[model samples]
Target: MAAENARQVEARVPPQDTEAEEAVLGAMLINPNAIPVVTDVLSRDDFWRESHAIVFDAVRGLYADNNEVDVVTVSAELERQGKLERVGGRDFVHALAEAVPAATAAGHYAEIVREHSALRALIQVGNEIAEMGYKRPDDVAQLLDRAEQRLFAVAQQRRVSDFLPIRQIVHESFDRIQSSQEGKAHEGVQTGFKDIDDLILGLFPSNLIVLAARPSMGKTSLALNIAHNVGVDQKVPTAIFSLEMSGLELGDRFLSGAARVSTHKFRNPRLLRQDEMDKLVRASAQLTEAPIFVDDSAGLTMFELRSKARRLHDKHGLGLLIIDYLQLMVGDTRAENRQQEVAGISRSLKQLARELKVPVLAVSQLNRGPEKQTGGGPRKPQLSDLRECLAGDTLVTVSSTGERVPIRDLAGETDIPVWTLHPDLRIGSRLMTNVWRTGTRPVMRLRLASGRTITATANHPFLTVAGWARVEALRERDHIAVARRTPSPAEPLDFADDEVVLPARVAEKVPDERFRHLAESDVLWDRIVAIEHAGETDVYDARVPGTHSFLADDVVSHNSGAIEQDADLVLFIHRDPTDETKKGVVDIVVAKHRNGPVGTRPLAFVEEYTQFRTMARSDDREPF
Candidate 1:
């Protein structure tokens, strides 16, 4: 009885279709064309027999290299890979070919093999889950999560997508393009910015768009704006995962933007005027009806995010997903370092986007590259500045004029001229510097109302009255580049001066040229010559004529505002010197559209509210 029981246990096997696997392999060995039909549908792991797996892997290798997949070539490949003997040599390869009735049923045979493979995988996953449960892990929740992830992995493996011919793909693509061109279909969600829409053609499904900027550069504001546009305006279901900000905070921001009420008024409802209160009530009603959902759970891991996202997608049919910022996401503990962890997170986010078939807008914080620069320029964000969030070989495709081109090439093709003021001029206790410093040659152009134009080199001191006279228009231009004073190598060091010593390192202190100049001149005490507090402005007698004065009105006094008067439209960037809570500006830049001519679109920025809005025509104009 014991021997019979053992034999019965040995005979019982996991699910598999040996005949299907043999037929599929035989078809591939007989006809090379049949390989493409099932290559995507099946893999070596799908074969239950080890020898069959080896034979299939050899055929796959040959097919991948564009080599013939006949019995002879497959046999040669298996021998080259030292797997011929393991797979019963050339006789087995020949036997596989002889087993196939016809290569026409290769796809059907491949499907049967895949079905059986999935069953085997399911059994394996169940056994693993049973083993894990038997151990009774301390963290039941974590164990359950692992079990679900394993099950999900098996389910994903079972999903087989067929390859379409180029003609079919092209026809579908043409239809989509035609619909978009005719304004009958929207290919992706609109960003609410017409200029940006023209440049990018809106955000497409399954795209992982990384929107990065320094803190307080309107990244959140822009993202919120887009979400509101899609959810409220277009009636699309949008989900936001705000790891840093609370759901209430996001709701308040949405109310502030939609109602045109200042964020300050939202926080302090008692201060809201009657008109603002009415607007707030209406905005709240509208938002309550919008298909926007917010999840403000803090410290969400990638797995948690995916699970929640999947639920939201299944229930609400999510059309768009937004991550408030990527850095705050909890990474895998097993990762070697932060970079590897972030890379893994980013890959998962991209996968989520594809699986859900929706655009994922991931907000990212730029590094302190701008502040660490020794050159006289404002630091602009670059792809490399993404901080190891993406792989080096990752390629981004942009579709324009019916042709898909690399994003790098598109940037080069759409290069625009940028200008900046002389950096030596002090602005808000710091030198005004160029943001875009590379390949920039200063060319001064002046157009008078009389249709006459004047051109000159920008070598003249831009801060001087003479330089101002040459510039008739300063529109769409912000920032200035100050020439750094080069230290003379021949100058002897003054060791006698107590303040003048060898370069010393200081903790948490950044070196600045303005401070160095003040130190050398023995005028460090004169730095605070003017103090402009809220509702009061005081100036000391020793205040410099053209230097920026300290202002406590949540504003920075800069020369760019004065320069705007001469131009038709000037780009203005404002930073709050006193408001450390936000640590950045609301409307950091207002310049020309990427694909359009130079112009300025006024956006109202309430420093106290930390919100941005389209300026009303009736609203009083303020200096930058």
Candidate 2:
């Protein structure tokens, strides 16, 4: 008995040693979840999974034909394109797999990876099922056979007394809190004209949320609005982590957006009146007094957020955590790959949300995938724009583009707000509907304007649908990314997929400042070659576009909008300078127009223009 016990004990790991303890604690400092990944990757068997093969394939597809695999660089590469899915998307590939092939080890390594991965996942599941408490498979197997014989059909088979127990826990939670009718009489909380889903999904103590978006749209604006509503309006203890911007910077943007002042103009303190200053002072004072906290670490780590968040809640009884964006977070593993690093960060955030029982709002970035879709038509954003994340209990994709037709002789063009993301203009982090529609319905007509005006009579005359939906969206965003796939696959693996090779000069250009800052002639000329070389996309002409003032090194493929002075520079977009030889396309001319602070000329593009700038690089590896 002693010998057997000694052998068994020796097989297992001893208690955490001093060195191991330091490493584990350090790794989890940013995100507690990094512990699992660090521990799991200790063995090849744990690192390799059948599910990972598909991730590798998607990763390989990102590079060009002239490129060779650099084992040290692939993970960071995928993270930039937002190509790595958070859940089972591209992020998953970077997460579980670390096998790097030698330059001489030939064939489609991606395909080989996928095949092996599928097999591994199957085996892994089987192993788990086999380990479950069997209490003798003979008795259970005989019992199952007898039940099948008596029931005799798949349609009518299930265990009895499923819900008979565990009824007590439900009633216990339900026992607390006031009833709806009684609760309504007390002054707090308003339904944004929409009937409350009313399952009572409150922000319990210590919850985190991920709220994501593209650029210049309104992520912080929306976040602050919620903080105001919760901390000041509802008296909930809330905290916000602003990684890229400072607390002061956040305060300025919030005031400018909320008060309808131009962000640039508001900086000049001399321009304010006594009353105006009072309003600003009052808003700031009210916010400071509220139980709202802010963390503005420019290079924030997941460990810092968790540590700060935990301390804030524990000490102050914090209720909610708001991360401005997920990418800004650094996790424990200094994984060689950025995409994998982000996956570790994301995994930590989800766990934090669950563990704390409070909703977390993490803002995310949309990939440039929509701009890649083809044809000379406006690209509507789908949930596909959100990188790393797929679908959650709630999801919201907000895309808005408006047009003005010169108000035909000075009525100053009706700047009709049109959400181009969807014809319906609302694809949600779904709560209880297949589609979230705007426009006209007898029951609901969504009319959100430039100044945050949602045209629905709130059950409480206070908030708008825009305000209401913002909260709803955060509450429903999935803790994990969702990938859209059906049983019948559309993209069959072509044994003859294109062999990608990157240009020797080009791959080196990624980290080169000189290559990025090339003179106009050289930059423009090289870009033309890359555009022509780029595999065909549906959105734009393959020919290179002429140079522009902003981000000249980077490719400019998005639908540009410039109305009067909205752009001080004229972008003479040219297609096929060699083939068509046209001097200019439609003269992307900018004139003057104003809609409050955003008053500038409108130059909305009918189609997006793709650029390959030598200057810009993905924020994966540092410039060597």
Candidate 3:
């Protein structure tokens, strides 16, 4: 049978010409024949494993009522039906196929991968060229020529060595076949499964996407969102290795996503409707068929994650990989340094993206400072906000007001908030990302819910240059301004010795006189609009010397013996607006004086005001 198959194979070989002979000799290898082996179609169990499952499924897809493998015929039909186009024509393909000797267990493909310096150099060159970005058409042609020449040598060599890491070949193969063409090609399965699809697609794959925020702002929800899209919608098989959550919990989230129900709301099965149950059942059936694999492998090190990802890719053509959160996993490399461990994890993720050529997303936590209560707008998360997990591609934070629009922040060098949702999906009548600057309250301008993906949008990521420069200058002045100038030459005359020439908007604002003003008499205050009392803000406030209650001195025409509401030697203690830490609780201390002192000395007491901005309405606090 082997001899007959060998003859049949020999009959299929094409004659080689002299011109082809000089370019390179395919590694002088002999073609071996096929052998018949018995297999059970009616096996003990109807389960397929490894490569056989995908290959056989594709074969089954090619079958028409006839039960036979008609690979060539289907390919021909696809071409005829305009589903595919023949590249370099059939003759070129045949010639190329003839050059490749069949691989055997002893063929040593791995070694070929290991020893193929030419292959490595070609890959390096390709990556370097890619990094160079778009080149002129002629240069592109030259690059293609160089790339083809490499394959020509490989074809001629006709050797499949075992040393080649399967992951490398898989990645290269995707690039060669998919990216080499002009238009976009979509991978069929959304695997909610893997990162390989997007990786092989040759797009920008981000390594770290920190989804930091106060807990329960849908960090896990968005991770699942990406995972589901890449796996199920994109058909890129994926791996989700979570440390905090069990596999079941993660799967439940996917179930919620598939069912279009809120994850928190889906906690109880008994409350689910009949339709929901039916949907769950259908989802389960589909999920069973889905290529998106989950490994709720807890406590994975960076090394283990990579190793597992490589195996998933090599064995089942994995497409994407996701790690729930970064801080959970520790690095395996025996480094005593915590930063090194973190750095190692970050570096490995970046390496994984490059090596696997897919977006390797790992969620991370934002530091304690991000627990801000917003007016429900997108707040531009900063790199400093991500200083905790700043080692990767981009710092991302997620914030959602349950029913409000969800915000995903890249936290670039500048404050740029990118919106991830389709506006139609938002819960509000007006839908836009509510992104504000990091330090500012969700106020005083500069909020836009623009940009898409981690990559910055063309115009929406930052304030205009003028605005940025002006704000920066103002900030610098706030930072370095010695005691407020007393009518300096740059300043307009009539300026109070300490009054800053505030922006027109601020000048327009009506200041509460209760707060102390940083001022000297205004004599040369020409350019300056108005200098009254600076408004109490979280960054600054006038605190009286001694009580939780703020002291505002408004001398009434009449005096009340109730001893209430009038200022008793109020000593304003405010924070520098530039002080990052003390800003949150800028206070005013009013040294308290008890009126129960007919002949005795006045009782000196203390009062405290918790926040600065709260002082603006201190008058509103029922004067007890």
Candidate 4:
């Protein structure tokens, strides 16, 4: 047993390279040039040996103060910090200086140290993940998200940049200016439209550009136009995160716009003429060659989106990112209010743009207040209008395993099958596709005779004795249907012991306060005892696709904004209703430009083709 314990201790040794750590420290101590290179990659914690870490910390301290970094200076800095005796005194520092053969290989040695440090971090993360698996958190999605984030954090350690001297920054700036003068460095990815490009300087990197407008104002059309121009015309790799539309739908629109054919005719191929069909075929072939990747998954949390974006950026060298309609995104569940959630999301998007060194174009929706103004020709959406835009604790049974889980815990789970009722009042089973966070709305809690209650929006529907009725339409004493038998999932849940969800029989055994056999039903009819307004809350609706309804609280149920400051640029799409002469002309309002002039750029909206283009005068035809 003692020998086995010894082997276990030996096996548990962390990854480290003491030789590389000493070599890097020795190089930095001897040569001044090696200090900058070493500092770029290695930090104090990156060193395996305690003595080497103390020496490196001293060297960094000297460098930070703009002092020459050498064996003498590092020793003095260590002595000043009262760490010299702890780090083997001045003799060890002199020995490190003498140990290095050359300073030119310091960067290579530093890389070795950084790599070992990264490996150590990864090992730590693995241990944390193992502990998490042992604990078995209730929300598996959040657990997975946190684990992914820990892994990403370790990977990002290598990319950490140290503070650069002003001299180095000035030299880089001068070089960039010279390159620009020589016509070698373009400002940013150019949108095909000259007018908009002139205003915003062509979507600069490390910037968050928000394109917002009311529904059907061609915001998505314009965004896709820019994406097409960058990915197809400029040959830059682009990623599109579409929360509102499916990838297939976006593909069809892209084909229609690029082919210059009417979307209506394109969707119905039979209506297309021979030339239009040829154009579409040619456009489809061209689109296949473009470097535009699309992820149309619904309700992506910020962490999931960032993880995907980082993967794409690493794999394909992403140039631009576009998100359609920000309002559909789910922020951190811990946020106390919708405004705070939006603010967090806004800051995260900006951080992502900066981290990837790419431009982020996010689509946003405006509140209805813009449209309801009394004296409006066309109510232009302002930055403030962007702010006002748009969980049930009910235990739901997993149709597959008959495990009763809270609906709120399943916010982002897209593939869990649940028992549901079709709009035709037929009982069936379907995947609880998505839990969309329809932001804060007035809710009503209805109590049933069986003591089961559900809080939902007024429009949320439930199956009744008479056809399906919404919470608002149903009166008191109305009988609602509940499933009596347990749903047999394909496989038994492995996480039955996590206390996340209890099986029907387990609920009866445990008899916890939260545990009730409300899920056990066989077409049981229960009358609504009371209906009361439960105040406003961030409610969620599950999308059970074909059935269009999910069993909530054992009853069949029907399914169903911030960031002005964090954004580098804000664009509002406005269509003038009073102007009849310029039929489809819409104004791209640059509401806020952090570093440039704010103005409106006129672009023509081709409604039939679902495209945006440069406006043409009566005498001139300018290709957008």
Which candidate ranks first by TM-score, i.e. highest? 4
- RMSD (Cα, Å) for all candidates, in order, is 17.6, 28.2, 25.8, 12.9
- Give the Cα-based TM-score of candidate 4 against the true structure: 0.63
TM-score, cand. 3 vs. native: 0.36
> Whole-model lDDT for model 4 versus the true structure?
0.75
| Residue pairs in candidate 4 whose N, alpha carbon or C atoms collide under 3 angstroms | 400-489, 483-521, 484-521, 484-522
Clashes of each: 13, 64, 71, 4
Q: Candidate 3 lDDT, tens digit per residue, 569-606?
A: 11122223344554343232222222111111111111
Number of the candidate with higher TM-score, 3 or 4: 4
By lDDT rank, best first, the candidates go 4, 1, 3, 2
Q: Give the C-alpha miss distance for residue 150 in model 4, angstroms.
A: 1.3
Q: Model 2: per-residue lDDT, tens digit, 1-624?
A: 999985885575422222232232223222324423432222222124323332333223332232333322444555555644442453433323322222122223322433343454444444344444344554453344333322321111111223322444555445543443455421222211111112112333333333333454345555565565567666778788988788888777555533444455566877777776766666566656778788888888776676666657666765567787767777665432344455567667766665544666666553333333336532333322222111111111211211211111211222222111111211111111112111111111121111111111111011111211111122211111011111111221121112211122443556654433322111111111110112321110011111101110011111111111111111111122232432222111111111112111111111111111111223422101
Q: Put down candidate 4 lDDT per residue, 518-573, tens digits, no spaces.
A: 33423555678889977666666555544555677776565532377678999998
Model 3 poorest ten-residue lDDT run: 550-559
Candidate 3: list runs displaced more than 4 Å: 1-211, 261-268, 373-378, 388-624
Model 1, 404-456: lDDT tens per residue?
22222323233211111112322222221211111212233433222222222
CA shift of 511, model 3, Å: 62
TM-score of 2: 0.36
